[model samples]
Target: MKNMDVMLLSTSCIQSQLMKELLSESLGPSITLVNQHTFAYHDWNKPALILVDLANLPTSNQPWELYLRGFKDNISTVLLNTQDSISAQKLLQWPNVYGYFSHYEDQETLIRGLTKVLKGEHWIPRSMLIEMLLYLQSIKPITTTSIELTSREIDVLNLLSNGKSNTEIANELFVSEHTIKSHLYKAFKKINVKNRVQAKRWARCHLPLYDG
Candidate 1:
């Protein structure tokens, strides 16, 4: 049987090893586990998939951000988290963020999420998905602007309106926390808002049904 070449990144050496064992035991020797710090410097093109544990690492480093930006077209990213709201918002904006799984999710769910991501599908927990949809509904346009945002950017805006932090948003969207911040930085500039609080207030005021 051919093994799927997977690169697992985690700050916890033990957890990384455990995940490596799990993947090897379940899917066979085709999977390879590399330490997160080392994996960041390696060429990402060789992996069938890359699994990132956002909750376990720092998000502000330039190297990590560069790695993510560079790999968007070269490989798939599967972000695992404990549902950090702000993180979810930032990560969802990146086109490469394909899958998200909560730490609380069962093993079957984790496998299913990874499988879906590998198949080029975007996967988010059901509850978070619904919340995102509802947020979009709440922020429906009252007026169209000259400014434009991608569908994913708009999704990030809606989550911001719901008071989620970048970390939370990243987890929700299955993206790296750094990716989420990048989106917010661009979104804020485009929307003419200075910070998350201002952005949310502006969105609420401009959105069709927002009473505030």
Candidate 2:
């Protein structure tokens, strides 16, 4: 209620007016709702949350998306009236997008979610959060030398990436399966991987001599 700015980017004048009134009443009169069709003239550095209605935008690269690319720092955004989870997930991948509201969301749910977003908290689903985390983990830079893996661990990972099972790796290394498991566990911990598949993926990216 302390003059928090909320910019509504919508094409329809009637809808924008209605939404502005609703938000003002629900979120308190101190909340400033800057209803506008374009965002080019606004100061990008201001502390404001942008609520973009995706329904009125074209199917291609949106105006907000293009405008967002200009700024070096992240701008907080909440996507409204998203068609489905696929689009929501894709948009949420942008660092600025922290909240989403489907067309089917009730007034109460929308208001509650907006409140959370205003507090600088994420309003995304748990499943989406998990998927984002996994994606970030996969793309995160980890040089092979950074983890300082033991020679046996590196050998095990190289073989693992080449579709070799634990038993096969053990046989190739002339060590027992238990020893191979120990090496894998240590490697996984060092590399922050939870399982063989993740370890293998990491190996493929970091290990230059990986066969697979």
* Number of the top lDDT candidate: 2
| Model 2 collision count | 0
Clash totals for all candidate models = 23, 0
- Which runs of model 2 end up more than 4 angstroms from their true locations? 1-4, 29-37, 72-74, 87-89, 140-212
Worst-scoring 10-residue span by lDDT in model 2: 61-70
Please, what are the lDDT tens digits per residue for candidate 1 over residues 162-196?
77788877765657989888888888887788987
TM-score of each: 0.52, 0.57
Cα RMSD for candidates in order? 8.5, 15.5
lDDT of 2 at 33: 43
lDDT of 2 by residue, 73-168 (tens): 535678888876553336543447777888889999999988887767889888777876775565534354667875557667877887888887
Predicted structure 1: lDDT: 0.63
